[model samples]
Target chain A: MLSKKQARAFFLGGTLVTFLIFIGLTIYSFSKGNDQSNHENITESVVRGKKIWESNNCMGCHTLLGEGAYYAPELTKVIDRLNMKYNGQGEEVIKSILMSPVPWQPNGRKMVAYEMTEQEAEDVVEFFRWIGEIDLNGFDRIVSPLAKEDNNN
Target chain B: MKYKSQKVAYWFFALSMLLLVLQLVYGFVMGFARIGFDNLHEFVPFNTARAVHTNLLVVWLLSGFMGAAYYIIPEEAQRELVNVKLAYVQLISLAVVGVVAVVGFHFNYWEGRKFLEIPRPLDFLVVINVLLFLGLILVTLFKGKRRTTTALVLSMGLLFAALLYLPGMLPFDSQVMDSFFRWWVVHLWVEGVWELIMGGILSFLLIKLTGVDREVIEKWLYVIVGLTFLSGVLGTGHHYYYIGVNKIWLIVGGIFSALEPLAFLAMALFAVNMYRKGEKKHPNKLALYWTLGAAIVSFVGAGLLGFAHTLPQTNLYTHGTLVTAMHAHLAFWGAYGMIVLAIISYSLPNMTGRKLYLTPRGRAAFWLSNIGMIGMTVAFGVAGVAQVYLERKFGMDFMLVQKEISIHFVVLIICASVFTTGIIMYIIEFYKHGRPTDEAMEVSIQ
Candidate 1:
C-alpha cells in the first residue's frame, strides 16, 4: 500500500544517499594514505608509453591490468613472463617484436606490429615494468608466470 | 502517433537499424578472427573491428533511445515536439558523428580507451549532438500540458547520461586513474542512469500495452528505478576491485553488486504482474513479446549471469577473459537491445497505420533472435569458463588456450547466423511498414 508520493521519495532519497556514499568512497580510495594506484611512480616514459598504447589501441587486442578485448595476451606481467620463458632475454624479445616490420604471428594469431624505434620499444617496456610493479591486491599472482600449473604439457 | 512530430522518430529508428547491421558485420569480423579466419586482418584488424563493434552498439542503442524519447515524450506530455526541424538536425548530427568515429577507427585516428575510443575532438561533437537532443526533449516536455513521471524519468536519464560522458573525457597520466574515471562514464551509465531510461520506457509501454492504470505503472516505475540506483551506484566498485585500486572496492563491490540483481528481478515481476492484471489486450502482440522478453531475459542475462562472475574471488580469475564477454553479450542484448526493438515494434504499426500484429514472421523473429542469442551466450560461457581454468588457473599460454576454445567461437558463429536471420526478418517487417505518415496522427491508438 505504498503511496505514489512515498515511492517517489524512496526513489529520490535512495538515489541521493547511495550516490553521496559512492562519491565519499571514491574520494577516500584516492586520498593520500588510501592511494594504492602508484601515482608517484608514473614517470614521463610511462606516460609516453601509455600514449603509444592508446594511439595504437593496444587494448583492442591485448589486456593491461586485466582490462581489454581479451583478443590478445594480457600484458600485465609480460616482462616477468617473458623473462622466465626467454632466459632473461624478455626485454630483447619484446623489443624485437615491437621493432619488427612484419606482424608478430605466434601460434597463428597475428599482432599488428608497429615497427617501433628502440626508444619507443624501451618506453613500452618501461610501461609494462611499471604496470607489473603495482600491487593489484593479489591479482598479480594470477598473472604471474610462477602461478602456472606444474605440468609442461 | 497522436502528434505529427512523432513521425520524426521513424528516421532516428531507421538510422539505428542501419548502425545495428554495421555493428553485426564487425561482430562477425571479430568472431572470425577468434577462429583464425582473420582474412581482414590487414584492413580491419581485430582492434579496429572491436572498436567499431562496441562503438556501433553504443551508437545504435543511443539512436534507438533517442527515437523512443521522440515518440514517447510527445504522447506522454500531450503535445507535439517544440521544433521538429531541430530534432532532425540532432538526428543527422548524431549519425554523422557515429559514422566519422567508426571510420576514424579504421585509420588509427582514435583515443584508444576500450569503450571510449572516439578521439577528443569528436567527443565534443557527441556532446553537442546530445545537448541538442536533450534541449528538444526537455523543451517539448516542459511546454506540454502535462509532465508525467514517465517523461520526467526518461528525460532525467538522458540528462544524466550526457553528464556522465564528461568523466571519460578527462585525461590522466596514470592508467589506473584513467580506468577509474572511465568506469564513471561506462559503469554508471549502464547500471545507473540507463536503467532510469529503461524503467521510464517500460512504464510507458506497460501503460499502453497492458491497459494498466498510468498511476499504478508509474508508481512501480519509481520503485524499480529506486532499487536500481540503491544498488547500482555503489556497485561501481565491482569494476574498481582489481584495477589497481584499493582493497576497499573488493568488499564494497562484492556486497553492492550482489544486491544489483534485485532491481532486475523487480522489473521482471512488475512486467509479468502488470500483464496479468491488464484487462485490455492491445493488438501489438510483437511489442508485448519483446517487452516481456526484455524484462525476463534481462533478469537471467544481466542479473544472473552477471552475478555468476561478479564476486571478487571469481572475478580475480575471469576479469578479462571470455567470461566477461559471456555476461556482456546477453546483458546488453536482453536489457538495452530488446527494449529498443520493443519500442520500434510498438511504434511502427501505430505510426504507419499498419496493424500487422501477430504475424508469423514477427513471432519467428522473436523466438529465433532470443534463442540464438541465448545459444551465443552459452557458447561464450563455456569458452570463458574453460579459459579461466586453462589460462588463468592452470597458467597455460593465452594462444594455446584460445586454440582449445576456438570451437566455441564456431558454435557462436552458427548461433549468430540464426540471430541475424531473425533480425533480417524484423527489418523486412520494418520496411513493409513503410514511412510514418502524418495522416496516421488522427487515429491515435492509445
Candidate 2:
C-alpha cells in the first residue's frame, strides 16, 4: 500500500523521467534537422516530385512514412518494392509501372486507378527513389516501421 | 417505480450485450481477413466487416452508457427517473437507428470513415436520441431529492457529447474544416467526454461498494473533470497536425496532448489510493477487480501510448498504423468498458436481490480477458513499429509489405479468440449463479 507522500514522490519521479525523455527526443530531432538533403542528396527530379506530391495532395490519399490519409497505400517504399519486383532497373521501371494503368491484381485485391499524369508519375517515382536511400535506423521504435516488422515476425 | 428504472436498465444492458457479441464476431472476421485474405469474394468482405465492427462498437457503447446513466442517475438523485417512459422510447429509437446504420453499411451505403461511417440520417437520429437521453437525465436530477457530484458529472458528459456532434454535422466548404469539427465529434467524445462518464460511474461504484467518504470521491471527480476539459479541448490539436492546419498546430498538439495522459494517470492513482485508505471493503472480488483494472489499464493505454503519439514528430510516423489501434483498444475498454462492468457488478445483485460473486469460471474469464488484451496490445505495437520501418525506411510497396507483415493480425485474432472465450465463460457464470446478498439493499435505502 502506497502512502500519499510515497505516491506523490513516485509521480514526481515519473514526471522527471518523462521530461528528460521529451527533452532528449526534441534535441535529437532538432540536431537531425528537418532538411531532406542530409540523407539523400536532393536532385531536381526529387524536388519536382515533392512539388507534384504536394500539388496533387498525395498525402491526402496515401501516407509516405505513416503520416497522411489512410485511404491509400504508403509510398515511402514504393521505389524499393518496384525495384525488387522489376529486378533492379530502378527509376525507369518504377515510372513505367506508375504511368501504366495496368489492372493490378495482387491476391485478388483489385487495385484502383490513381490517374497520374506522365510527369506526375515520374515525380512520384523520383520522390520514392529518394526515400529509398534514407537511413532511418535511429528513430523511436514506435515510429520506426522497420523495427516493428522485424520484432513482430 | 424504482423497479421500473432497474428493469429498463437491465433490458437495455441485455440488448447492449447482444450487440457487443455481434461486434466481437465481426471484429474477429475482420481480423481473420487481414491475416488470411483467402476469399475476398465473400458475403462479408473486409470493408463490410470493418464497417460493422466500428458501427457496432459505437452502438454498444451508447447502449451500455445509457443503461448506466438511467440506472445510476435516479439512485444518486434520490428519486425515480423523471420520465421513465421516455427513457424506454429513447432506447428504442437508438436501437432502430443502430440497426439502420449497421445494415446500411452491409448494403454499401457507408460514408467511408472508420467510426464515423454511419449514414447522415442515422447520425442525425443518434444525435437526437442522445439529446433526449440527456434531457431525461437532467429532468430526473431536477425533480429528485438533491444532486450528487456523480450525477452532475455524468449529465455534463451527456450534454457535451450532444454539443460536440453539432459541429461535425455543420456544412463546411473545405474538407479540412469538415475534418476539424469531425474530430470534435470523434476525439472529443472518446478522449474528452467519455472520461467524464467513466469518472462519474467509477466514483459512484466506489462509494456504493466500499462505502468511501463521498467528499473525497467527489473531489477526485472534480479534478478529473477539470483535467479532462483542460487537456482534451486543446488536445484536439493532435489530429490537426497533418490535416492541412497551420504549423503552430505541431507545437500546440505535441505539448498539450502530452498533458492529456496525466489526467488519466492521476485518476488511476486516486482510485488505488482511495481503495487503500477506505474503511470499508468490497464483498465481491470481481467488483474490486473491475475498479482496479479500469484504473490500471486506463493509465497504460490512454496515458502512456497516448503520450507516445502526442508529439508531432512521432505522429508523423505513427499515425493511422496499428499503434493507434493499440491505444484505442485499451483506452476504450479501460475507460468505458470497465466502468460499465463495474456498474453492472454493483447493481445486478441489488436488482435481483441475490448474493452474487464470480464463480471460479468467472475468475478464469477475467484473467483470460486481461491476458488477451495485453497480448493484443504488444503484438499490434510491434507490428506498427514494423510498418514504419518497411514503409518509412525501406521504401517498400505499401500494399505488398502489408501483405507480408499481416502476421501480427493473426496474433491479434488469436488474442481476440482468447478474450471471446473469457466472455463466454463469464456469461455462463452469470447465468448459473447470481449476485451476493449483503450489499443488495445498500443502494435502495437512499
Candidate 3:
C-alpha cells in the first residue's frame, strides 16, 4: 500500500477528475437536446403546457419524469393511459376530466379542484405529449450488471 | 460543556426536539389520512401534511446540527463561543421563520416545489439566519487557539450547505431547469455537504467516546470526505436520470451514484475500527451506540438501498414508488437523524451534569427506535416491491394498487408508533438531564 500522504493525493485527484467529468457530461447532454425548439414538431403549446403543469402543482401527487410525489400515477405516460381509457378520445377525455369538479378519488386521498380553463387543459395535454416524444434512451432496457445484483438482492 | 456559552446549545436542541415532535404529529396526521380517515382532508390534505412533515424534518435536523456545532466547536477550539447573544438571536429567528413558513403552507402561500416549498420571501430570511450562524461559528473558531480538522470540516459543510441553497432560489422558467438545480440543494445537501457535517460530527464523537488519537481519526475524515466528493458530486446526476435532462446523466449518474456507498461504507468501518482500537472506554456507552449505529445503518440504508435504485434499470421500475420512500426513511433516519441523536446523547449528560446516559429508558430508546425503524423499512420495502410489480409492471390502476398497499400503512403506523415512543423516552431522558448550568462547565469531559 502507498503511504497515507499518497492516499490523500490520489483521493484529491480522483475527486477532481470525477467532478469535472460529471460537469462536462451534464453540459454536453443539455446542449444536445433541443429543449426550446419552436418548430412544427414542438409547438408553443408545449411550453405553455409546462407552465400550466408547474402552476397547478400537479407534481405534488403525479410524478413527471419519474420525480415528485409517489402518491399519484406517473404522468410521463399519462396520455397513453387516458387515450385507452377514453376509447381514442384522449384529448377530449383529458379536457373533460380537468373540467370535472369531482375529486378523482372520492374516498381516499382527494385531488384538489383547481379551476383550469379549457385552453389550459389543452396546453397541459400538449405538454404531456411533448414530454412523451422525448426519447429517454432505451427507456425500459436493462443493461447493467447492477440490475442482476439488484434482482438477486 | 466546558464553557457557559455551550449552554446555548441546550435551547437549540430543545427547538429540535419540539420541531421533531411536530413533524411526527404531522406524520400521524398523514398516516391516518392515508388509511381513509379523510376527516382532515379538507383542512390538512396529504400534500400539506407531507410538506409540513418533511420541512419540519429538515429544520429540526439543521437545528440539531447547529446545536452540535455550538457544543463541539467551543471545546475543539479551546475557547468559548464568540457571541452567545447572536447565537440566541439566530435560534429565535430560525424558529420564527420556520413557524411562519409552515403556517403559510396551509394558506397556499408557498411554491410548488417539493422540499423547496418555502416561499421566496422566507428564503431570504433563511439566508440571513444562516449567515448569522456561520458568522458566530467562524469568528469563534478563528479567535480560538486550535483549528482541528473536525472543526474546519464541520464549518465548511455548514458554509457550503448555505451557498448551495442559492441555486434553488433562482427563478427558472423550465421545469427541467428548476428540477436540475433543486437536486443541487436536495441531493447535494444529503449526499454531498451534509455527509461532511455528518463526517465531522462522527469524527468528533468517535474521538471523544473512543478516546482515540485525534490525528488517526482526522485522517479517516479526509478519506471519507474525498470519497464523498468523488462520488456524490456526480451522483447528483442520479436524480437527473429521467427529469428531461441530458441522456448523459444516465451513464454518469448511474456509474457514480453506484459508487456513492463507498463513502458510507468507509464511515461505518472507520467508526467500528476506532471503537475496536480504543482502550479507554468512555462512560457514555449510549453515545457510542448511537454513533456506531449512525455509521452502520447509514451504510445499509443509504449505500445499499440507495444503490438498489440508483441505476437506470431498477429506477425505471421503482422510481417515485414506495421503494423510494423505503430508501428515504431509513437513509434519513440512519445517516443524519441518528447522528443528531448521537450528539444529543453525548452532550446531554455533560450539558446538565447528570449521568442519565445509562438509564433503562435510554437503552429502551435505542433498541426500540432502531428495531422499529427497521420494521418500518421492511414494511415499506415489501409494499414497494409489490407496488413496482402491480402498478408499474402489471400496469394496474394506480388507485387499485394504492388500495392493495393500504395494508402496509397499517404496519407502518404500528411501527411508527413504536419509533415515536422510543423518541419520546429519549426526549424524557433528555429532560431529566435538566438545564445546562455553570456546574456542568466545571466537569472536564476531555
Candidate 4:
C-alpha cells in the first residue's frame, strides 16, 4: 500500500543513516583505538620504509596487515620470526635475499630480487620493525606461536 | 538506432570487447605464472599481470556501462544524446588513459593499490572522463520529455560511483587509516553502489524482455535498491575487521555483512517473479537468459559464497586466502559482468539491425562461461580450504602450503580456457554484427 515516493525515501534515508554510522564508528576508532594511537609518533625511518615498500611493490607478493597477495609469507610477524630465529639479523637476511633474487625452494618463495639500493633495503626492513612493534592483538596471527603465548591456559 | 547518436554505443562496446580480450590474455599470464611457468615473470611479473588483469576488468566494464548508457538513456528519455561528437572524444580519451595506466604497471609506475593501481594523474583523467560521460547521460535524461525510474536509478548509480572514487584518492599516512578508507571505495562500490547500477539495468531489461508493465518492474527496483543499501552500507565494516580498526567492527561487520545476502536474494526473487508474471514473449531470448542468469547467479556467488568467509572468526583465517579469490571470481562474474553482458545482448541487435537473438553460439557462450566459472570457483575453494588448514591452522610454511595446492591451479587453467573460449565466441558474434545504422532502432526484432 506504500507509494513509490515513500519507498524511494526509505531506501535513500536508510542508506544515509547506514553510511553515517560507518563514518561515526570509524572516526571513534581512529581517535580512541589502537590504530591511530600507535601511529601518532611515527618516525621518519618508518615512513621512509613505507615508501620503500610501496615503490618496490613488495605487497605484490607479501601480505601485510593481512592484506595483499598470498604468494609470500605474511610480513605481519616477520620481525618476530627474525628476532627469535635469526638472532635479530632479520635486516641483513632480508637485504641479502633482496640482492640475490632467487626463489628459495625450501620456502617456495618466488620473490624477484628487486633492484634496490642498500639504503632502500634498510628502510624496508625498518618498516617491518615498526609494524612488528604494533600490538595487533593477534591479527592474522591466529593459532600462531604468538597467540599460543598469549592464550596459554 | 532510434537516434543517430546511438550509433556511438557500438564503438564503446567494441572498445569493451577489445579490452576484454586483453584482460583474458593477462588472466592467462597470471594463471600460467601461478603454476610455476615463470617464463613471463621477467617481463610481466605476477603483480603486474594481476594489476593489468583487474584494471582491464574495471576499464572494460566501465566502457560497457558507458556504452549501455549511450544506447539506453536516449531511448528511455525519448531524446537523442545532447552531444554525440563529445561522446566519441570521451571514449577515445578513456582508451588513452587506460592504455597509459596499463603500460605504466609494467614499468612499476603504478599506485600499488589493488583495483586502484592507476597513478593519481591518471585518476584525475578518469574523473574528467566520467564527468563527461555523466554530463551526457544526465543531460539527456533531464532535458528529455520523459524521466523514467530506470533512467534516474542508472544515473544515480553512475553519479555515486564517481563520488566514491574520491575517498580512495585521499591520502592516509597510517596503514590502518588507509585500509579503512580503501574499503569504502572497494566494498562500497561492488557491494553498495554497483548493486544500484545492476538494479537499474535489471529493471530496464526485465521491462523490455518480459514485455511487462514498467510500473510493476520499477516496483521491484525500489525493493532491490532498499535491500542493497540496508545490507551493503553496513557491510563496509566487514573489511574493517582485523585491519587495526575498533573491535566493534567484528560484531558490526559480521552481523551486517551476513545480512548482505538478503539484497541479492531479493534481486533473484524479483527477477524470477517478473519473469513468471509476464505473458508476452520477447524474441530476444538470449538477452532474457542473461537477464535471468545475472539475477540468480549473483545471489549464489555474492550472497552465498561471500557469506562463507564473511564472519569475523572465519575471515581471521581466510582474510587474504584463495577463499577470497573464489568469492571474487564468481561474484564479479555474476553481478557486474553479467549485467553488462545482458545490456549488450539486448541492445546489439537493435543497434546493428541484425537478428542475432537466441543464436546457438550465444546460448553456448552463456552456458560455457557460467559452467567454467563455477568450476574455477570450486578449484579455488578447495585450494583455499587446504591453505587455510595447512598454513593458518597447522602453521606450515607458506611455500609448502602453496605447493600442496598447486595441483588445483591446473584445474583452474583448464576451466579458464573454456571460459575464454566462450568469451571469444561472443566477441566473434559481436564482430559479425557489423555496424549500427539509423534504421535499426525502427526495425524491431520479431
Q: Each predicted complex: what DockQ? A: 0.84, 0.08, 0.31, 0.56
Q: Report the C-alpha lDDT of model 4 over B46-134, residue by residue, as the tens digit.
A: 88888888899999988988898898889889889999999999999999999999999999888777788788899999999999999
Please give each candidate's TM-score: 0.98, 0.77, 0.93, 0.97
For candidate 2, what is the DockQ-based docking class?
incorrect
Q: How does model 3 score on DockQ?
A: 0.31
What lDDT tens digits, residue by residue, belong to model 3 across residues A100-146?
77766634568766557899889988887776655445432222222
Better of 2 and 3 by DockQ: 3
- Model 1 residue B301 lDDT? 91
The deviation in Å at residue B372 for candidate 1 is 0.7
Q: Which residue pairs in candidate 1 collide? A: none
For all predictions, the C-alpha RMSD in Å is 1.9, 8.6, 4.2, 1.8
Better of 3 and 4 by DockQ: 4
User: lDDT score, residue B217, model 4?
Assistant: 84
Candidate 2 local lDDT, residue B6: 51
Question: Where does candidate 3 chain A have its weakest 10-residue lDDT segment?
Answer: A139-148
Q: lDDT tens string, model 2, B1-446?
A: 24346556766776777887899988787676566553642466555666677678877877888888888888888787777788889988988888887787666565554467676677788778888888888988998898887888888887877887786776543334445567778988998888888888888877876678887777777776666666766677788665444455577667779889988988899888888888786677787788778988888988997887778887776776667777878887788777776676666666656546666786887788778878888777877788767765575656666776688888888888888887777666555544333334444432
Ranking by TM-score: 1, 4, 3, 2
Candidate 3 Cα deviation (angstroms), residue B230: 0.9
Please list the residue runs of candidate 4 whose C-alpha ends up more than 4 Å from where it truly belongs after superposition: A33-37, A101-109, A150-153
Worst 10 residues of 1 chain B by lDDT: B437-446
